[model samples]
Target: MPKILKILQEDHRHHDILLSILENQVKDAHLTGEPDYDIVSAIVDYFLTYPAEFHHAREDKIYEKIVARDASAAEEIGHLDEEHEACEAFIKAFAAALSNVLGAGIITRSQFANAALEFIESQRRHIRMEESIFFPTALRVLTTEDWASLDAELSDTADPIFGSQKEGQFEALRQEIMDWQSTREPANDHVPGDHKLRL
Candidate 1:
């Protein structure tokens, strides 16, 4: 229940919500033959605003410090860092693919679907690793002083993506994400015969 862990956990909650929204959108796209650009844009915005900016910043500056300070975690921390880099690469590639489709409409819907699925799958695994392994390791390794410093750093860091209105912008983003989640029914709710979870 350290402050740093609390903040990171909150950030993970947002990530989960966003992932759910993306999953819902993908399901809708598959069923209705409709591309939900709004949802796609929202996911991209989250990468730009939260994951790429806030989450990466905290992990690199704060969490990395804890990992570096702990000699016992050196190998595990190195692996985690590589995974983080891979996740970032996937995000960038997904964003580029989305932008290409949106801009030129050259990529077919199936192609977009495939790309999005890859992104989602990679992200899902990455999140699981972080939540199950990385976060727990961080909690065990970092001391009170480390946690306090992380909290302070997080508080002081201003989101360049949102400028001076970061809080207001985040509030609006949160509401939009919540609204989408509320309105969309799960694909499984209306599945035809003998539907099973694929992955």
Candidate 2:
């Protein structure tokens, strides 16, 4: 596989881990009467800000090229642009519903669960679509020259939650990811180094 597709799959794994944390919190909130609003807020903020705003935008840029190079591939995926928008919307709604906990129009835990579940399902589906279909196709079809152009266009949108430079706000999420990562085998477990085009 070309390095970019590998990097994308690694990104998907990170996203999956984060989503699992969010789901666990949602389950706890459902069982207990108290929700970890802070953790939930951090997660929602991270998703809306980083993955939705930055990652999806980067993918859309590559997707543009994918469509240009292979029209049939584009036809299969349809409008992933819309899927990105939908994820952000779902997260916003989830956050709003969580925020409702502190007010008169409090959403029940079940309602919050539904919203959270929807977001998780959507994200997993999107990732699976990319991993199973898009990544393989792009690796097979997208040229090194194509990746070079995309890499040139790619901005330095380093992840705030999982990047080298750890920012202040995402500390909890970072810890959660790190703690989860630690449990897994440490052999060759590095997040894919950012790809610098060599060809």
Candidate 3:
């Protein structure tokens, strides 16, 4: 895999963690009568801004090169641009629903749960599709020279939540992720030097 693909996959992993956190909050709402709106807002805000601005843009650039180089790959890749747009739309809808719940308490628990889970599942499916089909096709079709050209064209955009420079607004979410990871790690397992928490 190209370095870019590795970065994208890492971003997907970070997103999965966020989705897990969101899911937990939704579940906890059943007992508490309300979710943590601040956490929900932070997660939604990150989704609304990050992927559209950085992650998907990079994928679109690479996909464009793939289709240009091998027209046959287009059939295999399907319409990724449309998928990205749909993902963004889902995020926006989810954000709006969250806003409605926060501002007016108009949305019922069931309705909010449905919207949140749909957003999470849809994002997971899109990531799976890209990893299983689009990414593999790129590796099979795109040349080293193509990757080099793409590397030159793409910006090394930092992930505000997971990157080296942590954004202040995301501090709580970052700590949540770290806490979540700690529970999953073995008692004696060594933390990787490059782990996000360490950074």
Candidate 4:
């Protein structure tokens, strides 16, 4: 497996764990009638910034090469292109829903709940599809030359949350990640309905 693909898979693992956490928090909010705004905001911030800024861009960059190698691979990855856009839309909606729930705007509890659940479901489905379908196809088709080209074209960026630097914007997200990591069980192996991802 290439390093770039490994990194992408690792990023997906992180996203799965975070999405699980967010899903649980959303459920909790329904029961308590008070949403964990900080956590919700943190998730929104993380998705809005990290994945949008880096993860998807990285994937898209390599995907361009993948298509260049095998044009049919383009058909397989087509949904993901739409999914990337859908994800952005969901993030925006989730953020706005949170704002309404937090009293900065006007959103009903049911609306917020619906948005969170929808976001969680869509994200999970996207990850599962990528893992089950998109990745293996790329691994099978892409060559050493393709990987080398990708590696040279894309420079490494330090992760603010999982890496050395801690940015102020991700303060809440950092705490949530730390808290989840400390207590998170081992074994990222996916069994049916098991959402924990090995850090």
For each candidate, what TM-score against the reference? 0.76, 0.84, 0.91, 0.87
List the pairs of residues colliding in candidate 4: none
- The Cα RMSD of model 4 versus the native structure comes to 2.9
Reference-based lDDT, residue 120, model 2:
84
The candidate with the higher TM-score, 3 or 4, is 3
Q: Report the lDDT of model 4 for residue 168.
A: 81
Highest lDDT model number: 3
Clashes of 3: 0
Q: For residues 4-78, what per-residue lDDT tens digits would candidate 4 score against the true structure?
A: 777777778778777867887888876897767787788888888888888888888777777888889868777
lDDT string for model 3 (64-135, tens) is 988899988977789889999999989988988998888875988899998998999889888888878988
- Predicted structure 4: lDDT: 0.76
Query: All predictions: root-mean-square deviation over Cα?
Result: 7.1, 5.2, 3.8, 2.9
lDDT of 1 by residue, 153-193 (tens): 66555432223435543454555565765665555221122
Across residues 1-199, which tens digit of lDDT does each residue of candidate 2 receive?
Answer: 5445555666776677778778778788657866577777888888878787767877887788889899898877778788788878888887787678756776777887898899888888888777777666676668889988876775666777666765798877677666656564444222233222111
| Candidate ranking (lDDT, best to worst) | 3, 4, 2, 1
lDDT of each: 0.65, 0.72, 0.83, 0.76
Q: By TM-score, is 2 or 4 better?
A: 4
Model 3 CA deviation exceeding 4 Å by range: 185-199
Error of 1 at 24 (Å): 1.3
